[model samples]
Target chain A: MATVKWPHFFHFSAPHSVVNTPAHRPDTRRSKSYGRSCVEPPSLFWQTPGHLTTLGHRIPTSRRAAKSHNITTKVDPEQVALLIKNEWKLSHVTPLYRFRHTQLKLYSKHLAAFIIAEKQQGVAVEVGVEAGFKVTFSAVLGIAETKEDAETVFIQVHSKPLFSADTPKAVWRGWLTCVNGDPEYLRSLPPDFVSLPLFCSSGPEYLTALVKSWFERTFDCSFGSLYLNSTMLNWLAALWTGCHPTSNIRYLKLAWNMPSQPPLDIAYTVNPQDAWELWNSIHTEDSTDDRINIEEVQLFMNGLEIHFFRHFKIYLSAGTLTKVSTALGSAHHDGKIKIGSSDYITTLLTLLTECALMKTPV
Target chain B: MDEQARAILQRVIRKIPNKKLQTALRAWDHLSSEQLESLDYAQPKWLFLENLISRCEENRLSLKDVTKLEMAYYIDNPSKGTWHAYQLFQAEGDAVSVNFTQFREQLKAHLKDVVRHVSVRTKKLEDGAVWIRIAWGDNFSKPNHLKPTYVVHYLQTSYVFVLNLMSKHKPFLYQALLLSTRHVSIKEAQLSSRSLTAMRDLLMRQYQQVFPTNQERTLKERNAPPSHPSIEKEHAECAERRHQMACEAFGDGVLPKLETAVYKLETKYRGNSNNTLNDKDELFRGVVMFSSSNLLESFRHCVSAGMAEGPVTPLLSSITQKGRNSFVITDKVPGAASQTPAHKA
Candidate 1:
């Protein structure tokens, strides 16, 4: 129910109306070319220093030495225009274009807000040698709830060092409440107020760097475990090529303390609860007391391990290895697990009973 | 558990001939408990007759009434029955009584001969023929050309032998006639031996037609030619181009224009403030602007109601002096020595 806090001043309804109407309607007098002639180019208005210098105050660009930080880039008018044109074209034909368009707009609005805010702060910026204004997309650390006493925090950029003068006094006073805040509750505050980068002119590589910087900030703030949503996986995949992002984050679900509930039929794969129970029965109580190494057992239960571990947190431990050798029936050895021409029906039945059990307990 | 099943079992066990009793018992033992219970024990004679008939019928052997009546007599009253006429003049030996082995062998020979004589055979269909055929219609229009229906010639005879419609099921019919002939005589069985060879030859021909001569090519490949790789590639390229065109037309063309308009409108409205607008003034202005245009009414109303905007929390601030240069009084934090790199391995 909680909606994103988009800027009220920048009304984005014009595009929505344009999309709602027929694209090639000759009867209606609405500007079919998306008001290209109505609005002046960014070059004309943005060049006026006094009017636009406020954008720098909100986003301090190129604060570090030029060689150390190559982050000062400005948004281009033509590119944005092209981006808009592409979105408009897709909206009419593609089935998913509408949804994608909405997401793009949301992201762009955030980016635009940052640009406006940074400019208002009256800070000086060194536009990079690579020409045109571009912004570094800020990582969303967490969403904060608006309590009565607590003031709403804008897109916060974390500062290094705890108990520093730059750390906001309100953060030390325990005013902010982020939804994705670390459970350990570190006291160090996010010191910088940053603008969201709307356009990624430098590609995802630069975005990856920005993300890495955010991670460093987050880690500096808290020495405890950091919990990230699964959506981060998709973001990382988009940012980096050939580098498997999931590999870096160790599976740490054991600390989550998930709620105990019956598995729903909505899941496409095997039921985790059934798999857990089956594991318990097959391995015996004593064997289960220690952590089950996923690599140690060569069971051919497709997706069983993933399903169980995903839902519930199980700690990995270096303990005595107990193998469920009977169920496997001598097919796989060591790490090499290959499915052979075994009795398919029997194997299916075994998986059904142990992993994907549909029967509810009496 | 039922009396009928028990009676049927007893009758089957007792009536089975001595030579083949062991084999019959073994086959019976393989039956599940449910199958055992389903026997018609009330009419044991009929059950024996049916079982024999089923066995012969399975081999696609057309039978005469004389054969059935004789077979029924032999099964029901095994002690009173004499050796069949076909067995009387066998070159190898004559038998006083018909045993399961001799009866089965003779029956197979006779049925094969009968089928070869009665059934009609035609040249291999070029387009191919399906196993089943009725009135031609859309539902059953074109027979699957992939499946070649090979025929075994059989002689038409006026024999009152009852049978279910099982001509389509060649394999089952073939097996039934071969294993369960009771009334057929040795003379009749011997006379049809030549016809049996012809039946065997027909079956061999059908098998050859069904299977591909070459071993490597799978049935799927044999039935239809493999799709060309170029065609698949072209199809994929076409889809990609279509998507690209769509995105270019809408996303790049129209969407950005609308966004620019929105940005322009925001700047236009905010410029009218003259640095004197309070929260109330801004709210009133927003409401008026929204009322005039349908685009921003929801946003204006939502903001006025305090449904979205919360109290402002400034994380950091710097002051810009009126007369002198702007001084950053807020950058007081000591910098860290170990800065995390922009990219880490």
Candidate 2:
């Protein structure tokens, strides 16, 4: 009955301490309106439907349970690269990098808040911070935590802050090589470096390489669990999986309402021709006891259009199904039909029949 | 009858066209002695003379119809200048003799066409008036966008006057009046009864103001009769004064009455419940009524003064009473009763 934790660790820092303290400091003036009061912890953990497991609790490690937990974790370097390559195949990777750079540039002009979350305990912690702050409290906190646990930390010094500022190109080149070329060097860096809110004011591809290198050098891990929000994690996972060529990453959940403006163009990596074949493969592989995850099925259906119906019919013919109507009826009950399809009427009729059978008082 | 009177009568007859003069002579024949006296001829004893002179001038009556005795009667009345003048017009010429005869005929034809067009245009106006009355009763009515009350009022008043005048002077013109009122409801036409009464009152008031009897006249007039010093001048001045006064009184009284009657009728029939009388509609109705009434009165004055056309008295009487009575009867029972001889009689 333990609730699943989102597989992300978040490090948050604001210019002013949001925490309320009664102590008066002459240098730092306090405002009464600064902090919100914390609510009391619930009496029972499982009483609430949406509560996550408490810290230090063991997460379910079974593949099926883990997959259902809404987090994808990778423990191998080859697999991480493969995922990244797959993401690149699926989207226009260049535009993604360009967009990331633009966001960084725009955010640099204001008082910024930064958060970095790590998906795994010992995998290199991800580092990110807003561009402008006189003193980054997060960097200071990391230093303090490192000092407290010096015996457990091993720090590999790559580009110091001064070197990054003075010789940026050289530092960038070195950072890139350390991340993409030398796995051992990347694995040598301390996990605390990940905890430090590092500045990334460049393209997303560069930032991705830097982060991956930092993790490899710091923890000798190619990929552990992703610790970013759904969008970033989806992009990185797709990249690792080699599902697409371009890295224009789209997280299905986040895609519902993203981009303050509508995207100029949207491209899907899944071929319209292959959609029917893929759908048939899923049905053939799935057992009566095993049900298709409705979400993946819906996403697949979203990419299909009228052009795929002919191929889909062919796929249906190849399968040893009783009557096509019965098969479609069951499929329709499962909500597998795309709502916006031109064949909505036909599909809806089939779906109704399927739903009736499923709910036939058995 | 003297030879001079016969020459004058001949001269008058020469001035008038034959056809019109014939009609006038026929009308004269029908008049009683009192009616002839009311015309106030200069020579009373020369009645036959005046009558013969009037007949000789009538263009409508052929010379073969007149006896030598009638011509001899005309020779003796030397002082009957007014009668002679009327005969002159009657015997003047055919339609070609009068400069405006052809034009008048054209005008009549054009007017007939206009009557057809206006019937169509005025349908909405009449309907609007009816609707206003049905909706709002006698309360103040708003002007309609399609047909303003002022225009409709003017058209109705003009139409009634024209009918009256045509029936009196030229019975032929009655056809046009009938055509004009073809589509007008019996109720709508009867509304003119109120207008006619108002007009009669206005004319009487005007006549009294202009030519008051010696008793009712000013002291100055009594002190200095027509025989007194500057008698001719005084008479001229008095007539002028009377005319001015009549004009003013008619303008003030008759015009407003016509406007009020039209407004009341429209309000009783077609006014919208929500709309109230706007100042523009009131001003427009006032101006139109005054102008239309003035036009009719001026035309009547011209006839009375021997300037233009036939007398309007017969036409006015015919339309105002007969037409209005017919409207009342038909309006009372619009269907079966209208068809019955009992109602028609």
Candidate 3:
């Protein structure tokens, strides 16, 4: 069965000799390292569960020469174009549309890997004080397979920074067409353009609006937890995609929805002097000698204002990350963290007092 | 010749789809009478029949499977096959029990349906071993147009193995530990209890190398540690080094909060599996804080450092040179609103 000259019947069309061609049967050579000699290279064609005929044989055809024969019978080019245009419009305008319509592409494998890893890590949802209230945003970065399929690219829709030299070139090429719609301009780009770290902002005004809404929803009632709205979550996911080389916090102030009573917004801001004193005292309180648990370090750092030194410490410490990210994602999406905890309320008030005092001392 | 064999052949041939039947018939017709005569033995005929049935099954399995084309592209690439072959050699030395034939036949049998599954498919065998099939390809086209080059089979955590029929060593092993950019935790891979420690240690080494803690750098800077550094010492050293690196990378006067932006980028670079830059180069390349004071100087530092490395320099310089123009600032809202009539509503 192994010696059957079966592959001879189906000649590979390529003029160049490929190793898989019947003419070149795999040899019985020993690898220098493996120490295992080939008994018989497994037959490319194998016996089926029930014997019938050999498969995987190729027929010779010069694809270049015969390519024209495969073309579909022509319709009017204008009509074809119009049909495609109408189809695209129908898909995009459909109320049930889930995928975004855009020409930009992203790294497919990287995007897949990122999404899988991120979902496992889970997005952190924090319903806490920043300017008013802050929730971590996520973004999707996608790779457009084709112009028609761009609608189905992994629909991460907001703009943030993507940090990596390994970012695929196709992503930038498609993005150039999406944003500029100029072929000449895309051609003008340097060969290495797509590999650069990219940052796309929804702009200061838009980000502030997102925060304002986040604050409004959280303050609507004293609650157990506040889940992030789907709209904001979607916006965050879009912005975070394809953008990396990031900071510990990418924050926007919610001055638009500042609570007028008690001027709580003013207290939210951290006084660096006070924050440092708190941090030092935590370590030195009982004795000069103090050993901190990794968990406490994380909690302490999470409570620090974005302006505080503890913010940088969180990222640099053995890749140690707090539940802050998880807390944020969960508080917004899963509604797990209870707001009734005295510790949480105190922290919130402390943050508010810091902001309020920083503005106009009580 | 045998009654039972002939009956079985007839039954199997009936299962072949019309498209595959055509292929089998065409292949049969292409064979000369002498060649046909050579396949008179029951064994050869049996092999032929089996091949036909397998082909039909493959066609059915691949139907509507979006990622098949992409997988084929990777499988067909000779260079990638050889590279994986080398990797398997290093990882599997006598430890892996499955020979090439058993692994190949099992993979070929299940690959079709597994590739088409909607969610990522991971199957743990009865023997307490786990295997996952990940489809990999560039975003050139959708899963259908381009054949995927490789369907990576990560076996436990000890090895990532593949059998490339395309390689010169057809049906040989390829190891992919150093080559693959995708980093799934060893625990996620679910290794045998015995190999777990070894694999975890190997992964830890790789992780630490990529994301050297400040303690690791400081200890290296000192040439030697006075003793085994405690966890607190390590954290403290790391924190101090981080502060110094932040000041040097950004500026002394930069806000600690603002400085974190650069630190975060460094941490990200550290965490990334694909970055090829050394620690020093990473410092320059990864510190991407957009300081108002002198963004260009920082970018210039990256380019100059990046030039020492050949591959990353172009990418580093490209972002630096084109950074300003890359982002487009567009209005989020329309200038005016048009209200449709209540009748339409």
Candidate 4:
């Protein structure tokens, strides 16, 4: 028989095993039976066959056998690392585990780089990511110190569209790479990150509700002044954020572009108490020092009346008499109230005269 | 008498009714001898014959009576021949003599019946004449020709007459008639333009005697009851004055103003047309065209040379201005007025 050399193995005595026992003695009979049955044992369980074995017995029979037999061979530590790195590159490694390790390292590096780059760029960042979506990548971008110093940066990535759409996983992976590569580039993004569609949206109601929830989640963050254009969305955000109490939102703009006939109902969603609170805040603040201009207030009032007349009436009642008078005068000056009928003109004139008289020093 | 003359005379007598002839003749026969003698001979003779025949036809007398009377008057008189010659001469000179006698007989008969009817109808007016009064409303004036006239007739025993009684003032009568007729209620009887003119004319005519002189009363002065006249006359004058004022005010100027104002109001409010006046704005244009030839002659009757600021002034001015604006005064070509001959020379 030709002598065979087995692969090198490390050996050590069992920590708790007895040295001599009749059961532990080598059984030649069992060994011959095991040889006749060529079926290999499970790789992990294969220890020593029939108590004692020749060196040839320890060696693998074929190349496939050698693969199974080599499991016990002591692997070099550097070689293991190299092997893992190579596997990651091939993408055979599970993406979750790879993401976990890769984002953590990228986050640390980008966080430092973003902090330095944000100082140079006057622009802001807006990051939006939903959970279970690109949130993994967003989380990495959000952690960057440079992204934090941005004048106005939003980071939000919705998970539902990214995961559920027909997009390939590779595309998301590519997005993840782009987002994580540079936080400085993201901070230079334009103010209007998302362009609104020309036509009215069917999903405004849904989007409004989501935005309300978002406003609530982000209430504590320093978002500065928010100008929400949608009437319903702004109203809902105002309610959910609870910023009315503290007046954190110094300026709010609302736009309503509904048709003239069958005017919209805005009172249903807006709370009277919230409106009163907003009006009271406006009154308590010095009119000269107000950040919101009179024109902006008029625009807001116009939108309110257009969308919700009843709510606007209530708002007017809650508003300061001075402001109400000013608004009424402005309305008359603008010819917003059509002077078609004699009776209507008389009624308007009466109301204006009454208001003017009431404000006069008696 | 000639046979033809006799036939014509008989035909005329037949036209008189029997009952009227009987009454007339009896009155004629009852005439006292002194009265008959006091009458002119020719007239008495004609009357006697006419009455006698009329009585016979009425059956109050027989033909014998007519014959006896005629023979006694003609044959018994010795100068009968001369009388006959006078009668023939009168007949020849007058063509209507035969018919005149017959008509006289008929008038006598008619007068008798009228007198009897009046006496029976009005015992109080038996001795004198019974006067019948006729008054007409404004609208009736046009058709009836509201003029007062006296109709007199003498019967054997009494006289019958008809006297038209209306407002002494023509304008008063006209307005009163309009007020009484056109309106359902007294309030609605207020005089309108057309009625006003009629009333003014009526008043001016009717009250001419009371206000004879120009110094008698001016429009405003006449407003008060006349102090110079008796109470009854004063009341009449006052009533006349009021009627006149109403007519003049509503008719002369106010009505035209009111019409224009109503037209403007309708245009502004109701959006309707005023078709009451025949002389609409268009007619004024024709007047202007005619008037343009002799300005002085055209304006001769006009109160002023320049247009007065009145109801029609604005309309006239607007028309005049529009005409002037549209009028193009170009240089007259050599023979523009005379058209060139169709057959070129």
**Candidate 2 DockQ category?**
incorrect
lDDT by residue (tens digit), candidate 3, A272-319 = 233233334233233433233333333334333222221121112211
TM-score per candidate, chains pooled: 0.14, 0.14, 0.20, 0.13
lDDT of 4 at B208: 22
Per-residue CA lDDT of model 3 for B22-107, tens digit only, reads 33443434334544454323344457665543443444433223222222222322123221211233333333555434554455
Q: List residue ranges in candidate 3 displaced over 4 A.
A: A1-204, A207-347, A359-362, B1-65, B70-102, B107-158, B161-345
Q: Point to the candidate with the largest TM-score.
A: 3
Point out the higher-scoring one by TM-score: 1 or 3.
3
For candidate 1, give the lDDT of residue A57: 30
Predictions in order: lDDT: 0.23, 0.25, 0.26, 0.24
Chain B TM-scores across candidates: 0.14, 0.20, 0.21, 0.16
Candidate 1: tens digits of C-alpha lDDT, residues A173-236: 0001122111111111111111111111112333323422332233221111111222221111
How well is each residue in A247-316 modelled by candidate 4, as lDDT tens digits? 2332232222212111211112223233333344323344343232333334334333332221111122
- The local distance difference test score of model 2 is 0.25
lDDT of 1 by residue, B223-298 (tens): 3342775886666544434333222221211110000000001101111122222112211110000011111122
Best by lDDT: 3
Individual DockQ of the candidates?
Answer: 0.00, 0.00, 0.01, 0.00
Model 1 misses residue A60 by how many Å? 40
